[model samples]
Target: MGMAMTSSPQPPPPPRRRRSRLQSATTISAPSANPKPNPKAKVIPLLSDVGRLQSATPTPTPNGNPSPNPKGKVLPLLSDVGSNPSAIDYYSRVASNLAGAGRLGDFLIAAEGLRAASGDAGFAARINWRLLSRGVVAALREHGLPHVLEFLRDADRIGVHATVMLDADASDAVAAACRQLLDERIMAEFVEAIEALARFFVKGIVDPMDVLKIFVRKRDPDMAIRYARIFPHSQLLLCNTMEAFGKRKELKHALKVFGALKDQLGGINMFACRSIIDICSHCGSSVQARIIFEGLLAEKITPNTHVFNSLMNANAHSMSYNFSVYKHMQEIWCPS
Candidate 1:
């Protein structure tokens, strides 16, 4: 009976684990055929690891407070940047590294993180905002104008100085906006674009005069006034925008601009009076020209010889009116 049991093939010896002289408590074993993931393994996320961040549920701390990160350093939620210096550097470096790696999408994530991190505290002042802006502008060049506009809004929300973006590429941004308008002819898009450019003007990146010209060329006096009003100190801009309409033979637009300016307490200077008179002369509205001259007197605006000449030209079709203008000139400007 004992020999039969021995011949029955002793149950396969329990799998042997060969020992090595080098083996120690710290020694790592080769992965099994189906090794389970290590729960304690450390995972260092890249700066651009947006998914991991967004999906990370706040872990409870020893004090029962939920923390965004484990090291007792609480990070702000996405889109809400806080003042953590290390967090700022983490995002900025990730952006730069991804940019250098030619990973545009990842770079974008890092850029957003950097911008968000800059919003709450003085972090914006500490980092190179210009460099961050440049990276975004470069990466989105292939994208559309809507994306550009969205970026501007994001920057604004993040407390980035408007000047920071303007300095990055003012002319290029303007040209891109204009090019989009030319392609689509969407007035809404054009308005949005002008709004963006107006930010540049407010920051002093673009000349206000150029902006005025752009609005006047669109022939929408209302839109022109709307934007011009954004700059409370744009009296000269209003007058010049009004005068430009005269050259376009848009008498009504000029009149509207003049009325809006007057309503805003924009002192009607001699330049504005002359511009309106010229417009009346072009449109052959001698009656309107006469009304403006009288109003100038009421406002105590000094009328010069140049005004009399323009008044006379305005009344070219009316001999009596022309004689009256001459008499006025003699009484005020050319008494000799």
Candidate 2:
């Protein structure tokens, strides 16, 4: 039984794997004092050489991937874009892409970069700013002036005004965007419009007057003056605001605003007169405004077109129409 129980001979050991030449070659080792070059490796031109040779060979895309269409359409690198590379078309596409993606703020910044890059005389002459502005305005219209206002504030938060040209052509571009918002039948809230314009002064990117002029043209001067009251001591600003209230025939509120003016030295006498006249201009059959105008004349304040206009307006609905005032105005102007 013991002899039968003896274990069978042990299985033969597995053969050792032979080291493939590829594995042997790849082993890390210190270099020889004079290393021999590998026959498999090929020498290629450096990166600088690639740029120089791209015209003859295939160039990479704007994204820096190897060109699939080397012989096909070659996109000019942003650096080499000044000449014959469809730079305008390329940027236009880029602009539209960003806007479509809702990166309206970035589109403006990109536009600035493009303009700056092309600022070199070589590229400047070819850029049609108006054409480019079409894209800029489109994005602006889509994203809205509120976004642009916020963008301007964000730029200031990061101290970008010194570097960015929001005060220059960029400023005009943004202002145009604001104008676009006006034509929209669905207007933003009165408070929103005020806050947006106020941001301009917070960073001084746009002239407040520019916006006011727009509202005046649209016959919405009151809306603009409502914005003016947000400024410090804005008597001059409130001057128009009060007058606007009056144009709505809100005489009481208009008088209240006029009284609030801190004209201690009477320096704003001309403004005071004009404001009262304008406020009464539309207030049919109002003697208060005329009384004020006469009192101003008694104080020797020069009566300008505004003064006469207000006088005519106050008398418009009464027996004393503009014609009589017109004759009186001529008498005041023309020497006897």
Candidate 3:
């Protein structure tokens, strides 16, 4: 028991550790196996990194108000573009070509930078018939009519100007295209355009009947006549053509177009009414002309002095004119 007690006491508080210099050096030199991750770790997200993410991360809504990014910095906008040689070089070439060609629209489309640069909406609405015509004429002078025609085929109004611009030799193509449109039922869109083109082809203002003749020969007569009425200045052309047809004894065609013209004009013109009379007289359909004259008298459009003179002249030849036109004219006249 005495020995045990002495041995236990001999262990005495193992000398209060004064860290050995070697131990301290070892601790300082050795790397720890269970090291802690850095607080400023790359695992933390950046604002740009957050922005670049799509659909994976939920956007923050803190109390319905999101926290702002902690690491954001403003970046300069397009600062490097000025120094980009390729971009500048490309634009320089395009600009020179545009200037030489007087094609500012094309130049802008091909420029270094622009949004909404290409397509019909960008350039189509900006042009008018006259300016477009001048440009087309220049292109034809430089290139040829075929190229201009090809360009116009894309837009109906442009097609019209092209029609006028094309030489008569190209009429086969123009008429063929127009006929194709008629077949496809798209001619309504192209009708006025075609008429304008026809006027250009015929030189000077085209008679409405002439346009009708072109339209009717290829498409429906009623459809052509209807479209002719819509054209500005078509009335005089229709009226004159009707008169000329009557003189040439082309009775059936004259009467057919005349009736259509009458309806289009609301059947109210004294000029149209007189043409009917003359057509009937020459075709021996004076009876029909007489019927129309009586209807006009009933409508209170009394024969004018000039109309009466023509009536008197007609009557001098035979009772046919006298029995019809003169009788109608004399009834409306207050004897001088």
lDDT against the true structure, per candidate, is: 0.66, 0.55, 0.51
Tens digit of lDDT per residue, candidate 1, span 247-275? Answer: 88888999999888888875666667788
Model 1 lDDT, residue 255, Cα = 94
- The 10-residue segment of model 1 with minimum total lDDT is 72-81
- Candidate 3 shows a clash count of 0
Models 1 onward score TM values of: 0.56, 0.35, 0.40
The alpha-carbon lDDT assigned to residue 56 of candidate 2 equals 43
| Candidate 2 lDDT tens digits, 204-249 | 5345455544454455545555555656646666676566666667
Point to the candidate with the largest lDDT.
Answer: 1
> Looking at candidate 2, what is the lDDT of residue 137?
50
Global Cα lDDT for candidate 3: 0.51
TM-score of 2: 0.35
lDDT of model 2 at position 89 = 51
Q: Clash pairs of candidate 2?
A: none
**Top of the candidates by TM-score:** 1
Candidate 2, which ten residues in sequence have the lowest lDDT sum?
A: 158-167
